[model samples]
Structure formats: C-alpha cells, structure tokens
Target: MTSAKRVAIMVTCMVDQVMPEVGVAAVRLLRRAGYTVEFPAEQTCCGQPFFNSGFRAQAADLAKRSLDIFEPYDAVVLPGGSCAAMIRKEYPHLLERWPGGVARAEALAARTYELSEFLVHVAGWQPAPAAGAPRVTYHDSCHMNRLLGLGAESRALLSAAGCAIVEMHESDRCCGFGGVFSIRIPEVSNAMTQEKVRRADATGAEVLVSADPGCLMQMRGFAHQTGMRLAHLAVLLEELTR
Candidate 1:
C-alpha cells in the first residue's frame, strides 16, 4: 500500500474543549483521503478570541506560538473556518511587524487550508458512495464566507457526497458566534442565533451543517427547542461517506 501524505490538524479551541468529535471526524476524512494526520501537542487557541477581544499582544503571542508548531508541515488543516481564516487571512496582517514575522506568517498562511478546501482542492478527494442521501442545509460562518470566501467548497463537497443541498433564507447570514461578541452582547447574539435556526428550520432539511464549531455550538443552543439537528460538515460528511 502507498504511504499517506502527512498533514497537521489544527483543532480549534472550541473543538478541543467542547466538540472534539468534529476533530475526530476531520482526521478520519483526511485519513481516508490518504493523509497521515498529526495534532501538535503544543497547539492551543488560534489567538482569534484574544484578537477579536482586542488583546493584540496576547493574540500576537499566540499566533507566533502557533506558527512555530505548524511551520514545519507542508500542509495544515483546520476543522473550523473561523480559526482557519484567522491563520490564513489575519495572521500576516496581525504579525506585520515584530522582526521577520511577516515572512513567517505569510509562509504559514500559504500552506493552510480549510478542511473541505483541502479535501477538494489539495487532496482531490471524492468521497465513497453513500447508501442514501440526506437532505441538509448549510450555514456559512462569517469568517468562512466573507473572509475565506469558502462558501462554495463545503457545498460542493456535500453535493459530491450525495447530500441534497437546500438553500436556506439568508444562508450566508451570521449565526452571531463571533467569539467574544456572543459573550459581550448575549442578547443580540442569542437573537441572531434564533433567527438563524428559524431560517434553517424553514428549509425542512434533516440536518443543518456548518464548517465552524462556533456557529454549530451557537445554533445548537436553539436547535433542540426548534426541532433541528445540527452537525459540523466533517461529521456530516463522515457519516454520509461511511
């Protein structure tokens, strides 16, 4: 058997602490695509929470530490779009100064990719045929959609995996899990998530899928009451493909 290509999995803090199954699904998917995945023990927060909270120094420190841990790998994959965007889109700008930081940040950013993007664009993965297709709607996390412009990648992957994609009203709308934004203004945050759940529920899909854990967790808060099933794209794809 041919050896698997090596890749690093950046399990964002939310997945590590809260929804670890997403990370597990990510590994399984990558492994099936012939990748040997590793999680750096030194990996921690992507510094996005600190950066979003205006803790620039703390964010910078964490970014540098993350760069150090992921630097050696040819490819680094993130299960969540928010953290992937933090590293790929914001890292260079966040570390523009600090003596040679720009080169390091840009280099790492070039190699980083969101899971679906990597699976489709890099690995050229075509999932195993599913026994049955599921009707699902997708939530495009703010960072995933606007920043990373990855709205198509996940949808494409789901279609390729035989999921019937239902377009929800304002499918690209934010679920209001903006890291610190939710905690600082929970009233507005909860209202946004409620609306998100409402739109998703209206689709009559079996599951609501999102690429970011933050959005998944936020929507899940209202999903139980709304009678909606929520899942990360990794988990959803894994289940479908298997």
Candidate 2:
C-alpha cells in the first residue's frame, strides 16, 4: 500500500492532445484536496482503444507499461472516466494470461479511481459554495456510469458546489463517443450526440457537464445547435471553486 497523501494523475489521450486544460484543472482540484500530485511524463494511452478494437496483445503491452509507471503511487486518479474504467475494469482481464499479471493488475485497479470518485470518497473534500452558482445539466458517460457505477458521486459534487442540478432526460444514455466507435460509425454517433444535446438544451441549463472527456468531445461537435455551454466536470469544479 502506498501513502494516502501521494497521488498520480492519468491524463488520458483526449485530454493530453485535445483538451489539455482539463488536465490542468484536475491537478488544481487534487492540490486543493490536500494531495501531493505527480504526473509521470512517460504516461500515455491506457491501451483502451486497442483493447476496444480487439488488439488484445497491443493493449496488454500498454497495460503493463501503465502498471509499471503508475503502480508506485498510493492512488491513481484520472480526469477521464473511460480511461479510469479501462484500468480498473479491463486491465486484469487484459493481462490475465501473463505470469503474475492478474495479481498486479488487480492491485493497480484497487488504487485507481475516477476524479470525482477520488474527490468525494477518498479526499472527503467538498467545495465552498460558488458565488452565483450556474444552472447545469450532467451527462453520464458509459464507462463511468455502467462500468464504474458512479453517476451520483459527480452530481453530489456539483450540488455541493452550489450549482442548480437540472436533470436532463436520459442522463445516463450513451453520448455515442465510444472512442473508436464514433470514428467507425460517425453517422450513428452524430445522431446519438444530437439527441443528447437536444435533451440538455431542453433542460434550459446554462452548461452541460460531464466527467468523461470522450463524451464532452462527442457532444461538443453539436455545440452549434445547443444554447448551453459544454464543460468537463473538473474544469467546471475548478472554475466554481475559484
């Protein structure tokens, strides 16, 4: 077991390449919660895309690489829920065939947590109410909700931040950004995202918040049609706290 005060940040590929500000916001939030944050510069994709694409061998290699890089930290937290779920839910199965792999993967999985999960559960930290908190609606990304079972934790944090919670219909429905799934079938993905935006717009919320970067990216493509703004939960929280 590692020291509870030291934590590692797993900056997912989407955040690293597309929305780096999300990683910065995540770091700020972790520091605010009184943890020593470390970013392993060597960290890269968690092999989720490979695993999802049936490239198990390549995925296993990256999983082993990730484990070697992050295993030393007391806890691993990620801004993107899908990547967290990849480590927590898929690593063990992906590494099962290798000698001592399952045990190592399980150990890492036990320490890995989604950002909102780490903040609300491990840190037991709550934000001071925001000044003139904005009205917001939340989107439950697939891996975060179904695999991690973490829909309420984020909403609880948002509520604590004094944001008025507006429930969008089918909040847990997939935003159609299944990583490669969107790229493979963009028409279906676009349709799904449009429906998601329509629901959020219907709520009349000022911002549409999601803890998963993949979902945010997918919905953002349709931002022109919606009146509300799009925000990653980490960025929204960091802004609210400041």
Best by lDDT: 2
For each candidate, what TM-score against the reference? Answer: 0.97, 0.98
CA lDDT for candidate 2: 0.93
- Clashes per prediction? 0, 0
Encode model 2's per-residue lDDT on 1-242: one tens digit a residue. Answer: 43469899998988999999999999999999999899999998999999998999999999999999998888999998899999999999899999999999999999999999999999998999998989999999989999999979899999999999999999999997888889999899899999999999999999999999989988999999978899999999999998
- Using TM-score, give the best candidate's number: 2
Could you report the Cα RMSD, in angstroms, for every candidate shown? 2.0, 0.9
Tens-digit lDDT string for candidate 1 (92-211): 989998799999999999989999999988998988657687899999889889988897889988998888899999998999778899999999999999999999999999889999
- Which window of ten consecutive residues has the lowest lDDT sum in model 2? 1-10
Off by over 4 Å in 2: 1-4
lDDT of each: 0.91, 0.93
